[model samples]
Target chain A: MRKFINEPSKVAQETLEGFLAIYGDQFAQVPGTLAVAKRVLDDKVAIVSGGGSGHEPVWLEYIGPGFADAVCQGDIFAAPAPQSIVRAAKAVERGRGILFVYGNYSGDRLNFDLAAEELQAEGHEVLTVRVADDVAAAPPDRANDRRGIAGGFFVSKIAGAASEAGLDLKSVQELATLAADRTRSMGVASAGGTIPGTDEPTFVLPDGKMEIGMGMHGEAGVRRADMATADETVDHMIRLIVGDRSLSPDEKACVLVNGLGATTRAELLIIARRTAWVLDQAGIRIHDLQVGDFATSQEMHGFSISVFGLTPELQKLYDAPGRTSFFSGANRH
Target chain B: MRKFINEPSKVAQETLEGFLAIYGDQFAQVPGTLAVAKRVLDDKVAIVSGGGSGHEPVWLEYIGPGFADAVCQGDIFAAPAPQSIVRAAKAVERGRGILFVYGNYSGDRLNFDLAAEELQAEGHEVLTVRVADDVAAAPPDRANDRRGIAGGFFVSKIAGAASEAGLDLKSVQELATLAADRTRSMGVASAGGTIPGTDEPTFVLPDGKMEIGMGMHGEAGVRRADMATADETVDHMIRLIVGDRSLSPDEKACVLVNGLGATTRAELLIIARRTAWVLDQAGIRIHDLQVGDFATSQEMHGFSISVFGLTPELQKLYDAPGRTSFFSGANRH
Candidate 1:
């Protein structure tokens, strides 16, 4: 493998150690657990999230003011242990209670729900909001069965903001659910990511071919076809997202053109350009546009497009200042 | 050729257009040049930098209030035209004059110097500071000939901070030079990056082999060796950097572990863990640590390490608030 890893089995632990070394001033590890929590806490609903370890800057790096209060990381492509999630929640539990906002994966849902049960038993009110926004993962009628992808970023942002604004746990959970409901995402993969210690990729694509709507961990996509130009690919993805959301003219939305592991920012920019054009043609106002590697799949070669149709309340929260190692929106509207 | 690009020749322009679409509220293009300037220019000396287009978030994305005032973009891996540089400088030039800070490359030097002369003739005081911190590119005695890599980030940050603090053009240039002098960087590439529209990579490496000290554009490095573990690779690179800089125990420095395109963040975090451990062994104080894709070679599967030795003056400046799309150090000391 071309990865800079020592022991494949210890990659996840070492990754967290590395992260703590740099961000230790603002965050700390929960004792006896692979959970990281913000150094300081306030008497507000605690927003917590996490999942597998391959996606950096997702759940861990997002732990800070105006974002997640804590995150419980798991092994590569695996779910965190229930105890770890409970510990993470307890680490940041204030009088207002705890709120969980995470992607909807079978393992993740099971573990987070179990953690919520434990926290409730311990006398802390807890609520769960699972994000399921991947349009290609299921039919519209089965949206709740779809896999959560990059659209979870919007859910996290809105939930974090609402919590930071002193919302009650139930209100925060409602806002997170609303954000998840309004968001839709689709990804195209030019290549697949390899797990550490593995010489082979999770999957393979012949040269000049690409897969549309591939999951973050190389799950089946909608289809495999010849590689298309950036404009064409983005146009197709946008169509699916817009149609899935039943978005209409005059709608205002926040757009995130996220790079899967290996895609270049330049390509993301090109994709963003087409995205803006298409949305404009449909009379959709882009309230905000972010282009970067918000969520990744190891070294996968592709990108995902996410649109979060904004309600006025969600828009206000989205515009609130958020500071994280990988993202910042302070002093801006 | 797995990139999502419609026309390889138009990638750079499209990248800029995409960037403008997202950031137009705060930045605007120069009337007749491929240059981006901040919409609001303070009376302080304007700090400007630019180079080839492949390194996204480097020159253009760095334009903001406490960062770069303007940036002139070139084609992929090519230098911006002198006229474009002049136009960009003029767009942000205030009565306090302008300062140009960029990498030390033959094409860049020729163009930026020509622009400085033109700006001088137009009665706008202009100063230049070329960053040559890539230790592997030249021997210590010929440091002036070294190529600038990720260390330019430190130079720009310091220069921008000084300029934003209302320093004169000469002072800003001097501080930039100091930052460049104290910074050093080296990279390892397991594979080469392919320029857009090109069928082949800029260079090639045999499978399981890696190049040490490789340049961003696949320039020849010091040596090729069998791929090593992340700890071993980081140790080798750190040894060279510490020895070349004559770094001593108790010295303070800021560290940047920059990912080339395609390197997974998990790998980077593992690298950072090793970096912090190694620096601790040397008794060097890490004043700050940043790990991300500050500079990148398009989809190149490798990373670079930059060490910026900090003096009290530079440390103060480094701690000052600066905001950019890819970096933000605001609301913190």
Candidate 2:
């Protein structure tokens, strides 16, 4: 493999070890576990999330004052074990309660759900919010079954802000779910990411072909067709997401254009530019905008576009001040 | 090329257009020029920097309240024209003088000097601080003749903090020079980055080979050898940089492991983990640490290591709070 790794099998643990060594001022590993949490815990509803490794700065980097309180980690691209989640949840809880948030995927659902049950059995009040916002994964009628992707970062931000604002556990959970409900995302993949410790990519695509609606782990996209221009790709993504949610001309949204690992910031901005133009053409207002590698699939060459339709409540939460190791924004609104 | 782009020639302008569209809240384009600046320029020494494109979030992302006041953008891997630099400096200048900061490159030196001459002729005081920290590019006796790469980021941060603290142009320039003097960096490349508008990579390394000390724009490295483990690569890089600087065991420094573009966080952390261990073994103290794609080459599969020795003055500037659109840090010290 052409990756800068020691042992492919130890990529996850070693990454966490190296991360803590450099940024230990901000975080600490849950004792004897592959989980990480903020160095200092606060007395509020604790927000926790986790999944497999490889998506750097996602679950781990979000742990800080206004974001996730703790994160469980698994092997590469695999969900954390339920016990790991239970330990992380237990470690970060204050008297307020514990709130669990994560992307909607089969492995994650099973593990986080099991951990929630375990936490409740241990006498801690726990709530769970699963983000299912990839519009291409399911129709509106089956939105709950859709897989979550980059848009979930905004949901986590909303949860962090609400929890930091001293909302009750139930209120925070409600806000997180609302944020996820208002969000929809779709992506196109120009190339696949390589699995660690191997000389192979997760999947292969013939040259000049783009996979529309690919998942974070190189799962099947909507279709394989000739590669399109950045504007054309954004056009298709916007069409699917807007149509799936039946968004109206009167609606306002916070738009995010996320790079899937290897996409340059220049390309993301191009896509974001097109997204704004297209959204304006459709009479949709952009409440806020962000473009970067908020979410990624290793070094996959692609981008995902997400829009979170903003109600006044969701808009306020979205605009609230927030900070993390990887992302931050002011409450300009 | 596999990159998501429209016309290759328009990549630079389109990227900037997209960036302004998304982040226009914090910055605006200088009219009729490929330059960007913070919407509000404070009455401090105006700091400006820019070079080629493709290195996302470099000169452009560093523009904000506590950072650079303006940046002149160039096309892909090319330096900005003198006219563009003059426009940016003139547009962002307050009553205070303007300071030019950028990597040490012949093209940039020629252009920025011309701009400085123009600014001086226009009755504006101008100072320049060119960073030359690439240890591999020159012997110790000729360190000033070496090229600058990722280490210049820390110098910019130091300059920004000093300028924000109300330092005059000469003082800010001195601190920037100090930062550049204390910093050293080197890199390794596993694969070459593809240039826009063509199917060709900037350079190619055969599959089982790795190049050590490659520059950001794919400049030739010190040597190419069989791929080694992450530990071994870090070992080689640390030996070269530490020995070249004649760093003593008693010196304390900030370490930065920067991704060229396509390297994953997992790999960066692994290298960082080893970097800390290796530095400790050499009895050098790590005062602060950062690992990310601070400077990149459009998704190239490589990383660079930069170390900045911390004097009492340098450490304070390093810990000073600064804010930019893409990065920020607290004054923990």
Candidate 3:
């Protein structure tokens, strides 16, 4: 695989090393651990999230003031070790409790759960919110089992804003869960990404074909079909996301067209245009729209559309400005 | 080539349409042209930068409150017509005059010249600064003839910040030219990008080889060599940029490692790490660091390193926060 890396075995450490080199002022490594915690500590509920290494600027870059407090990362496509999570949680805790937010996946969930227990054992209050927003992974009856994708951004934003607003731990947890529940997302992959040091792609699709519903880690998509126009693909994905969320005509929602990886901003903007048109035609009001590679799968050429139905309360939090290495918002200077 | 587009022919218009759909609140299209101008006008020298399409968020997304005043885009890899530039300038002019900043390419230079003439004929003041910072394209004696790569971002930033600081037209023009002269960049391309609607790539490289100094639009590079590790390639690139600029020890510079397209953020952060080390070893203080796909050749797998030697004055402007759709700085919010 053509990638810029020194050694495959050290991708995680090296990546973090690089991040720390430039953004050292904003993020610091949790002592002796593979976790990054924000430099500043405050008496507010701490929001921490992470999963793997390949998705740069996500879990780790998302840590700072007005964003997540800390992030625990694993090797490429692997969940963070539980110890890493515990260290990250402890590093950022200021007696305000901790909220662990992450995409819903078996490995991440299990490790984070163990880490939460570790925190609780230390007398630290901890809450977990698993974002299961990918509709293609499960039916509505099995929504909780669906894998999370880009919609986790919404969950993190709500949690961070609520905590920043001085909400108590329990209140922040409730808002995070509400935001997670109101979110839905679906993705289409035109190509799979190669794991570092591996020549083979995470998965493959036949030439001229695209897979809808592929997970961030290249999990099996719902189906494969001939590659269609961007508009058509977005139409299909948005239908799934909107139908699963089932909002009324006047309801407003935040729309995010996230590039998985390797997708051009030009193309994402096109997808964003189509998504807005489709939503407008459906009589749905758009609360806000963010179109970019908020989450990715290490240079995989694909994108996901995420919609978060917003209540007046959630909308306020969603609109709150955030300052992360990877994300900047409207209120940003 | 895998891409998300409707018709290849409509890629430019469609992409801009998409940008306007969500960011219309910030940018408004120049009537009858493929140009976008900031909606918020002020009694400051207007800074405008743009070129071909495909480079999402670059010359276009850079337009906002404290960034660029307007952007004019052409078809993929081609310069916008003079009429478009003229229209963009007219839309954003607020009596302080206009500053045109862009990469030093023949097509862009010619089109912008024509537009400047048009503006001058209309009794509007206009200044032009062509960024030619790619050290690999020419020797120091012919630096003015060298092609500009990602360093154009620095030129635009300095110009925009100067304009926002309420500098007079002539002073803003001088600062922009100074910023351009202080900048140096070099790029390596692993794979070429496909132009819209074309099955063939703009250029091709052997699977195990890379081209150093390759232009953003696939211009011939200095040499072809076997693929090297990220650190090795960056070492080669930084050496040229530093030597060409002849930076003294104890100097300060802003380091920017920009991905062309298809390069992972993981790789870029790693590159940023190495770049910082190299600069530190040279005893040069880094005033700021930015790493990402600031300017891209759509879906091209490559990256460029740009350094802008900063005087105390330039440092202040560099530190000044600017807000754009894709980039936000400390001054934001």
Candidate 4:
């Protein structure tokens, strides 16, 4: 297909250069590793996160003062290598500590853990928070076996904000843990996204049918039912999420309705509207709402809804001000 | 044909409802109007803008503390009515003045002007800035008639920062003017975007073909050409943009490679990466870079690149800090 570049291989590198020029002011990058806080070597309780490229404002935008100190970007959806993770840790090597946050995928876990070990040997503080919020990645009883989705946004935001606000390394880790404990997310897809320079999708969807519980990276969801309206879709998703979480009717919550690459803001807003209506009718007070393409799936035509159960302290931190490419007002009411 | 909504009609309203609960805390209903903004009107100058719903994070994410004080969301790719624009202005009116900034479309202009006239009758100081940054809307001979694309982000940010930093309504208007003058954007579309709930696209593109200079609303580009590699496409678009603006080899500037809608971040990043390589080879001293779906055209698989030549003052404002739903660290470098 017609595209915008001279060579496919050169695309990623050039884009990174432009990305640096654009967001470089926001993060400090070490050649092989991730980008850390510009002056943030001061406090150790660090939070590092990453993923493959192509999910803009995801791994990178989520990196900043209030969230991840650094984020390692791999080639499109490819896991970053061990050296990159080690470099991310080295950049944020404050005496306090460092926490690596990411999905529970085999590639990410192995590399991040290896980076941690390498850093520990070098006498740098290190930790890792594996995000497994995607219920579709595993069976109901095997929730921990699930993969990560947009829920990474909430987890990373809380963790980064805590770290930037001067929480000690362990304390920051605990903050992400606490936040992650209260967070859950799931998605539905109408189509799959193709990797750049490749014609095949990660998977496939049937014509006139939709896939619910699809992972951000093309993992199959729990069901493939007949499609429905925006309201009906929201109802289906909310029912599943509420049933899983058993949320109280009166609890205040932060809600996120994200576009999975190909969904439009208009479509997303419609979904969010229906979600709020369905949610408000259930008496759940939505204290915050974020609707956009936060964590995309290449060009998949789908969306995911994530909820962050909040405590007062976590809420305060969620509302704190910070800088990043994607969000600075995560959960700010 | 699988999609994610119940009815097409109720989409925008629902989306705004969900948005209001979270990122929209800065906004409130304008009493019988569909527009929204912050409470207590912090600054005297209120910047208002909005149009079709599909271009998320544009008009919506732009309305906040440091950006436009109010936004008027419209139907999918349709302009907000006079009623909505009126609502937007009323909500945005903070006393210093109110300014309306939208694209050069007839619908947006007519409605905004009508709202301004009506608001003026009710005794409010209002100003207007119409964006015509798309070089293809009209020939360079009649650039004023060109359409506005995703470049609205740069214009809005610069103008909003100016207004928030206490520029008079006229000064803020001028800031937007200057930025728009220096900005030129062109795009390439791989596939077409489908209207939600509709099985067909507003337009169509043959597979393996590309349309150069397509509008944000899926309007046919100036020409459909064979798809090329990222660098080739970049060269084509840049030649047009550079020719239109007549930038000198030594001229410095910022660049944006934006997805029309369904263009993957990985794809866009690759595009951005390659574009940077080309400019670097030409010895172009790029000042900044923005890559993503800044202004989208639903799920259309395409991208647009915008270059904004900066003056010192414009650069400073471009680098200033602001917090909002879609962006942060949207400040000067």
State the lDDT at B131 in candidate 1.
Answer: 86
Candidate 1 Cα outliers beyond 4 Å, as residue runs: A248-250, A330-333, B248-250, B330-333
> Positional deviation of A147 in candidate 2, in angstroms?
1.0
Could you estimate the TM-score for every candidate? 0.97, 0.96, 0.97, 0.88
Over A1-333, each residue of candidate 4 has an lDDT whose tens digit, in order, gives 434444555544555555665555555567755443454355547677887766665676676667677777776677878888787766766677788898777888877888888899988878777888776677668877878888888888788788778878788888888878788888998888877677888788778788988777787778898877777888988888876786675567888888887887767877887777887888887777877778887778889999878888988888887656666464553
The local distance difference test score of each candidate is: 0.88, 0.86, 0.86, 0.76
| Error at B298, model 3, angstroms | 0.8
Residue-level lDDT of model 4, residues B153-234, one tens digit each, is 7788788889878888888888989988888888778887877668897678887888888888778779988887766787
Q: Which stretches of candidate 2 lie over 4 Å from their true place?
A: A248-250, A330-333, B248-250, B330-333
| Candidate 3 lDDT tens digits, B1-333 | 478899988888888889888888778889888889888788899888889888876777878766789999998888999999998999999899999999888999999999999999999999999999889898889877898788888888889999999999999999989999899999998888778667687789888889999888898899999989989988888888887877877567888889998888888888888898988887888887888888999888889999999888988897787876666773211
lDDT of 2 by residue, B88-201 (tens): 998889978999999898999999999999999999999999999898787788877888888988898899999999999999999999999889999999998888777787
B167: Cα error in model 2, Å? 2.3
By DockQ, highest first, what's the ranking?
1, 2, 3, 4
Measured by DockQ, the strongest candidate is 1
Q: What is the TM-score of chain B alone in each candidate?
A: 0.98, 0.97, 0.97, 0.94
Positional deviation of residue A330's Cα in model 4 after best superposition, in angstroms: 3.4
Candidate 2: which pairs clash? none
| Residue B24 C-alpha lDDT in model 2 | 82
